[model samples]
Target: MLKGKHEIMLKTSLGDITLVLDADSAPKTVTNFIELAKSGYYDGLTFHRVIPDFMIKGGDPNGNGTGGESIFGVSFEDEINADSYGLHKLKLGDATDEALPEELAEMTQKEYLEKQGYIFNDDLKSLPMEKGYIAMANSGPNTNGSQFFIIQRKAGTPWLEGKHTVFGKVTEGMDVVDAIANTEKGANDMPVEAVTFDVEVK
Candidate 1:
């Protein structure tokens, strides 16, 4: 288990980027990332997907945006914050509004929240998906593996809200991310010149 805040250093061919994982909000995901980094799982992987003004994606062993496994070799669920969506605004008669025991027993926490009219707001929507935000890349809900991406634009990506998992943010060196994102690419969005990564976790 992760004890406290953790920082990951990614030394890429373009340059170095540092990330501060959100352990408090996404502990399991943070721990998984740390373990993968320490084991050198991301040492030589290439950022396969690069769309200028969008984001730069990597962490796929195949370097084709199709292959990677979590440390447990299985998929994991998302860890989104609930208060970000005004769920805390709900109140009942003379009491703090909360899901009843019957509701909790019948459906998952996310389902219960949705039933209460709380749409999953990505990073609260208030916390814009600005430049340098790092999020997990998944096939669908709860499919986060080793693959992840870094937002390359200063504008907020509200479209991606509630869809992908934002597990961390770039603490420094977004210039390297921008450089990689601006690189020339061929078919399949693959960079013409390889951009590999080596991570140091602390």
Candidate 2:
């Protein structure tokens, strides 16, 4: 797996939050983030979307969750390694063809997986979308840009595993994260008072 060491400090309006990036799982995504952080691209950006028990999202140039781009000035493909999360194995056996849905009965394992729209890589190790994890926020497949979100739900959001590229996790200041999440929000889950921050790569 591709790996590198990267830690960043987010000096937010509320407090500081520290994150350690996992380049082994998402090298390109981490690289993009570090580039943006170093260039001050994320300075003074607001966490545009914040759900109390879900996540806090930001890094959008528009500060509305609809705008942002990578250092390359475009969206990039998702980095999802199914093996690390055990999402590569097919749950149903070939012997169960008779009981399977008509459309799936004749398909091979790979075909079935492709039909389900799961793209993965054997070279990388994708981390799960758990509490405190940081991930790219995209509209859909391969649409990743500069926007990102931090998981807040204590049990985690497993449903997002294959959908988003998880690049890092909170290493300190989770209470600051908690406070940011619990802040009063209005339209589009935006904090009534904007929650902006400056980030530093370490």
TM-score of 2: 0.87
lDDT of 2 by residue, 1-202 (tens): 3368688999999999999998988998998898888899999999988987899999999999889999766888788875666544544355364587766665545445446665667788788889999999998878889999999999899767667889999999999888999999999899999999999988
Alpha-carbon local distance difference test for all models: 0.76, 0.84
Q: lDDT: which candidate is best?
A: 2
Off by over 4 Å in 1: 82-128
Candidate 2 whole-model C-alpha lDDT, 0 to 1: 0.84
> lDDT for model 1, on a 0 to 1 scale?
0.76
lDDT of 1 by residue, 47-108 (tens): 99999999999999989988988986766766565455333443332132655565455454
Count steric clashes of candidate 2. 0
Which ranges in model 2 have alpha carbons more than 4 Å from their true place? Answer: 90-118
